[model samples]
Target chain A: MILKTNNLCKQYQHKDGLVDALNHVSFEVNEGDFVTITGASGSGKTTLLLSLAGLIHATSGEIRIKDFDVVNASDRKLSDFRRKHIGFVMQSFALIPYLTAIENVMLPLAISKFKKEQKYQKALALLKLVDLENRKNHLPSELSAGQQQRVAIARALVNSPTLILADEPTGNLDPSLSTDILNLLKKINKEEKITILMVTHSPLAAEFGNRKINLHNGCIN
Target chain B: MNIRKLVWLEFKQHKSQLISGLLAITLGIAVIVGIRSISVVSEKAVAVNLDNLGANILVLPQASNVDNYYAADIDAPTMPEEYVDRIVSSNLEGVDNLSPKLTRRVKVGTENVVLTGILPKNEITSKPMWQQSGLLGNDLKASCAPSNAVNQSNGYEDEKLQRKVIDSLGADECLLGSTISRKLKLVDGSSVIILGETFKVSRVLNETGTVDDDRIFIHLHKAQELLKIPNQVSAIEIMGCCNAISDGLLSKLRNVLPDTRITTIGQIVATQIQTNKMMNKVSLIFLIIIIFVGGISIGNFMWANINERRKEIGMLRMIGFNKATIYQMILAKAFVLGIIGGIIGYILGTAAGVWLGPELAGLPVQPIPSLILISLCISIGVSLLGSILPAYLAGRIDPFKNMQEV
Candidate 1:
């Protein structure tokens, strides 16, 4: 397994009592697999996805990515883990408004010790792969919703992370744009042989992944 | 790719906030530099005044006033030359320069003038603001030519040959004040007979806007011979730096010379010191207020900036930037702004100081480099202090809440 969770649990404590956001979740995805996790609102989809990416730690149980215990990792190590092994695409596309498309694509490599020219070359090549090389110099505000999303995808792959976690990658896109984003992801998954775990509420969006897992009330169904 | 590049981009994008923040720091730095310049210029003015007046303290012989009043009113009472020797031998600390003045009212030609005798020595030239024109008398130069060459030049002489012959008085040469010079219609080359003796004029002195404008200066021994007063002086002019002349010193002199009364320049020095102290205090208060006010303004601006950029911060975290990186970027922005503000403020303030110092204090000032460096640090330090809280806030932004909001 490229990623695994053994009865992982995460709880948020409220004034009343403990509220379980993720309770005893267990799942595994093999290498090169594209898995879409589908759920309704408040179904622990984001919490599970965040925990799997080590963006948040599990309250109990174990989370292993490439056999490294992410749940017990230090904050620095967790950040390094994210930098070197995982890429994330958020619902809003989350492009830095001040940076050009190419600069945004170069963000993940910002903390890396890569040479400036080398990082720029990698960013330019990724923008090319996303088919937005002509618009690389444009800012996020100047780009359309679809073009911005394409830039975000280029950013996620900048560090050449083995796994990509996309949270509602098409939530703000129109139907045609959503189809384009999904096809782009499928191409990256198949051509680059990079694993992808996507979280979405749309059934049509889940259909693009190689396998689909439905979540209800914080558990796999 | 580094924090600096990111900070520059952020600053470029947020022009309004950045400008306001930098302006505050610049104002604070300007105040610091301006105040420092003012202090330096004021000190220079005080020093110049002290120089012009000859000494921090004056010692006058106590002639009889039925009520301990004006010594200048007395006619015959004179302090013996022994007092001068006694004071010098007493080994008083901090006495840098001393000149004994012996005055006699004598008829020279048709005018009755106060003829003050001064030793033509280094002590005479040490007095600041004393100006003269023309040459030392040819007779005096023949007697003391090479030994007094440097001093003749000290009297503001412009001509090389004239300077070599000026103010190097022997026993008979004299300097006349502007009043005496104009009254007698005398240029520097004129001569006047006094008490059956004659002396050539060495210079026609400039008007000092002081009592020195009314007197004529002659060599000490010559005045003694003319007045028939051997080994007696009217007063002593002693000048040293601050704290050198005080009441305690006067008391010691009185004990040594019980027959005579003594007066010191305590009032003038005290007043100058108090004035300097008060000015420095006011400047210090202004400096403190500027720093705090500027810091608060920058702090508020940074807080608002962090609040508006929460989503951007979350995006950075999601893209794998650690909390440290986020914090560094925020502080880098503040630091760069502080540096820019400091340099601009330094330039403007120094320019103002150089222009305004002489205009206000009537003294030229060149602010030291150390003062500029200190002001720069203060400006940058205030910026760093103001941005700490906001940078911390930026580092602690919750990606989960940010995602939900988006």
Candidate 2:
């Protein structure tokens, strides 16, 4: 299993009482698998996705990524692991507005100890993969939402991670653009052999994943 | 990207803010440098004048009302002559040379002249002290040879009138200053009747380029006799071996010769110098406040910049930037700003200081180490302080929350 969680549970506490976001959730995904998690609003899909991403910790659970026990990792080690292994794409297409599309795509390589020339070549290749070569110098504000999502995808692939976690990868796109984004993901999985874990509420978006799981009342079924 | 590129990108985006910060720092540094130059120049002026005064100390009798060592009204304190004998035998501490002089105001015709009587040995020994331009010493022969035009000319001849008058008076006469001799038309060896005694003109003395240029010098005993003052002297001039010994020796002289008032030259210069030092301190304090103001301004601007770039930081972290990379980016920006601002501020400040230094000092001034040190310190200090807050703010930006907003 490339990623595994044992009896994972996440609780959000309000002033009144405990709100169970995820309850006794256990899951596993093998190397090279394309998986999609589907759920309604507040149905624990995001909470599960975040817990798997190691961004937020589960209240009671064990998370293991590859051979490393991510649940037991120190904050510093977790940050380092996040930089080295994990790539995340947010629903809002979190491209740095101040940076151009090329720079945004280069962000992951910039952080790692990659050589400058090699990092730039890799970033340019990734941008070309996303068909954003002409729009490399344009900032996020200058790009359409679909273009921004493409830039974010290029950024996510820059680090050459074993697993890519995307939240609502095409939730904001029109039907035609959504299919194009899905086709891009399918191409990346088939050609690059990168594992994909996506969280989405749209059934059509979930159809792109190789396997789809439904989260209902905090339980993945 | 790398820290250098990160800083360069930030600098390009925020050029105007950096320029504004540098402007404030430049103004503060300029003020400090200008004030520092003035104080340095004034000190140099005081040092030059002190050099011209032969020594840095002046010793007068306790009851004498002399303004300075050369003043004519100075009276020898009517104390027992044992005081002089004791001063001579004890080798007064801090005193390199102890020369006693007698000064009297006497009338030469209608003009009032101050007369000074000096012991030949002491006077000749003190010649090295008066070696500034125009003052002649026994060792340095006069440039022109004495002419015999006076002995060969008639009194009635206009060309020879001065020579004839000089011849009428023999040697052992008066050596009139140029101003006095010119006004009286007296030549070398001219005899002048004064106080019922016929005094012959001797070699006319050259100008000392001092107040002494207005006075005449005669044999000490002759001056005492001419003024009809016997056994009584005027002022005592004391030259200290070094400034370190001056204060202690002056106090000792005042103590031993209680009847004689002792004035050290350091005391005279100290009062004004002390005032100048206090003013300098005030200016230094003001400069410190100004530097801090610049620092606070820069700090505020940088902090706001960090806040404005929060979403960008979030995007970087989400894409795979670790905290260390973010830290390096922030710190690199701050360091670049510091170095650039410090160098630019230093250059602008130095230029302004050099241009305005003399105007502030009330005279022309030369650059000194103290001024440069002050400017550099202010520049570096303000730059560091200004950058600290921004660096911290940049570090604290949470990628998750900022990304959520985006």
Candidate 3:
């Protein structure tokens, strides 16, 4: 298994008392599995993704990603784990506004021991893979919605991570651009054999996944 | 792709905010350096003035009530001129320079002008201190040199004569004070009748802004012969050595001359010293105020910057930048701002000091190179200190919380 979570739970203190954002969630995904997580608003899809990526601490859980326990890891160790093993894609295409397309793609390797020329070549190759090689010098604000998302994907793939965790990756795009992004993700999945756990509200996007998981009210249905 | 490059790009993005922070530090350092420079130069000028104006101590006849040294010899009771020999023979350590004078009111063209008799340096029969101290040598020479056409013909050839030390004066020749020379229309090499005796004017003294400006100077023996006070002097002016004066030279002189009235010009030096001390204190107070105000301004700017870049910070964290990295990035930006601000502030402050020193402190100042390092340290220190809390807060920002907002 590439990813595993057993009896995962997340609780939040609200003005109205304890609220369970995630409750005893359990799931598994093999290497190269294109797993799409479908959920309603506040259905714990993003929360589960965040917990798996070690962005958030689960109140209770056994989350083992490739034999490394996410829940038991220190913040620094989790950061290392995320840098080496996980790639995250967000709905807003979180490309730093001031940096160019290639520069944004190179952000993941900033703290790495890799040589500057090596990092640049890697980021350049990723941009080419996303067919944005000609627009490498353009900033995020200069790119269209689809082009920005492509740059985001290139950034996500630059580190050659074991898994990609995408939260509503196409929620901000129109249908045509959504299809293009979905197709690009599907192509990366089949060709590169990189596992992807994507959270989305669209059933059409969910259909692109090889394995599907649906969530409602913080529980699997 | 490195942290430094990332910081540069971010600085470009937030140019306005970063510039504002930079300006705050620059202004604070400028004010500190400018005030300090002026104060330093002013204090030096005062010390030079105190050293240049001679005869801090005066010895007058016991019956005289005169407090002013210049007027101490005018119509004063006479003391034995042998007292100069007594003090010289005593081999006192602090007696740096001495000028004994005898005065009388004499008619010159129907106006009664004060005629003061000063002992010639060659007549002092002891080792002179002027050679060692060069006391009143260069400055006095510069003052006596004719500054305008009206006094251009009043030049003297002897070094001591130009220095106003009067190593030797002819019995028939007299030095005219600036005011007296102008009033009587006298010049060097001109002859004037004083007390029914024809005397040649040797040189016209410079305007000293003192009672001496209105008096005429002649050899002591000549005045004694003319006035018939053959063995007496009105007052003895003493230039006490600086270190000796501080070590109770006045008391020592008083002990030696028990029958004479001795006084010191300590009040003038005391007032200048007090003013210097006050200026130093004011600069210190201003330094504190600038640090407080500048620190707050930079802190506010950083806080606002961190708030605005919350999403970007979270994204960096999500992509694997740890809290430490985030913290370093913020501090690195502040460090760059401080360094640039410091250099620019030093240049600007030095310029301001040069321009304002004369207007504010009545002294012309030069840029002190040592203050550059001090300005840099203060600027960098203030910038870093102000950003510490904000950097910590930025590091603590939860990636998930901020990303969720996006």
Candidate 4:
């Protein structure tokens, strides 16, 4: 297993009263599994993905990535764990605008233990895997939305993360482009044997995963 | 790997903001350094004047061959040397320096030079010029220094060289004034035939831009022996009397040495310190205002950088960047901007200082490395101080919230 969660919960103190974003979620993902989380806009699929990624604090419960408890770790330690173990792909392709495509991929490796040349070589191979070798030097603005998403995906895998938490990876793309991205993720999952946890609201997006779960009223079904 | 690239990307993307911040520091530092340099240089000029030049009062034997208006001046009947001790014992707090001298015109190699014999005791000739002359003894050392007294004396002495020079001069060595030195083409450690004997040229006084420049200075005992007057001084020069106190000292000297003719040189000293203090007050006020504005510029720019890059920061956090690295990156940018501004300010400030010192403050201060370093620290310090709040905000940014904001 690459990730495990037990009764994990997250709450927000809104003016409307305490609202549960993640309510007693329990789940596990085996190595190399592609798990797609589906729900309505505010049904807590994104919140669960965030909790699993250690991007936000969970109100209560256990989140273990390969048996390392994340909830109790210090903020610094959590960042380290996230940097070394998890990768995130966002909806709008949050690639730094000033960096080129390959440089975007190298961002995760900036503080890595790899030497400079090794980091470069690793990033190069990932760019090739994402089929962006020719476009490596292009800025995000110069690339199409599809190409930018590819760069974003390559960035996510730069650290060879144990779990890739993608929040709406294809939401900004057309159906064909979305299908292409899903197929690439599936290909990466099978070939690299990496676990994938993705959140989305689209039924078509849900079909790309081997296992699908839905969230309603902050509870999993 | 590629940490510099990340920093460069951020700076490159926000060049205009960085430049404006840099301008603020530059302007602040430029004015501060320019005015400061003026004050520093002017103070040095004052010190040099106090160190090397005339006393306020001259006490001469009354009506003694009266400062020869036409031909070579003859030595007057000596003022009682006991009068030196009398004025000293009177506990006059205003007296800064006092030296007795026997003055006469002498023929040195066919050139008539005003030879003033001054007691080169450490206390008598001592008004600490920048350089220590072996002939002037410790009187040429820095005055009224602080605990960094050692620092004040550093490079001012070469004891061995001075000792060798002083050792050769007891009654035989003589110091050449700039005019005499140039006229005679004399160099230090050269043999000069004076008073029918070979005297070693010990050191030369710098050009004084006054009548002293045309004079040759020899030991008091040497001049007395040349004049066949044993144990008598022609006059006493009293230091520390500005125009403010010249009248009172003249009366006191006339009473103490009843047969002496007292005169005041009226060395006003220009009150350079007061003038410099006023200039300094103005500079400080301007500096504070400029620095505050520069600091705010840096702070505002940094905060905006954080705000604009929320998603980028969040992305970085997701990829394993920690709070410390985030803070460091932001602060490092500010620091680099500060350093750049400091360097530019230092160059421009030094130029302004050199140009304006003599014109406005009438003080010539050479730019030294220490002053340059101080200016660098000030500009950079202002930039860094401005980054604290922005760095805090950068560090505290929540990755998930950052993603949501975008």
| Among all candidates shown, the one with the greatest DockQ | 1
lDDT for each of the candidates? 0.75, 0.66, 0.82, 0.74
Distance from true location, Cα of A83 in model 2, Å: 1.5
lDDT of 3 by residue, B207-300 (tens): 7777887888888889988999999999888766544565577788888889999887776547555766777798788778767887888889
Q: What TM-score would chain A of each candidate receive against the reference chain A?
A: 0.98, 0.97, 0.99, 0.98
The residue-by-residue lDDT of candidate 4 on A123-188, one tens digit each, is 889989989999989999999999999999998898888988888888889999999999999999
Error of 4 at B341 (Å): 0.4
In model 2, which runs have C-alpha deviations exceeding 4 angstroms? B20-23, B37-39, B46-54, B58-263, B347-361, B364-377, B402-406
Candidate 3 wrong stretches, greater than 4 Å: B55-269, B401-406
lDDT of 3 at A3: 93
Interface RMSD for each candidate model?
A: 1.9, 2.7, 1.8, 2.1
For model 2 the local lDDT of residue B395 reads 55
TM-score of the second chain in candidate 4: 0.52
Deviation from native of the Cα of residue A159 in model 1, angstroms: 0.5
Local accuracy of candidate 3 as per-residue lDDT tens digits, A1-221: 89999999999899999989889999999999999999888888888889998888999978999999999998888888888888888899888999999999999999999999999999999999999999999999999999999999999899999999888888889999999999999999999999999999899999999999988878888
Candidate 2, A71-111: lDDT as tens digits:
77765677767777777777788776667998877777765
What clash pairs does model 1 have? B55-B239, B136-B165, B136-B166
- Across A114-165, the per-residue lDDT of candidate 1 in tens digits comes to 9999999999999999999999899999999999999999998988888999
* Better candidate by lDDT, 1 or 2: 1
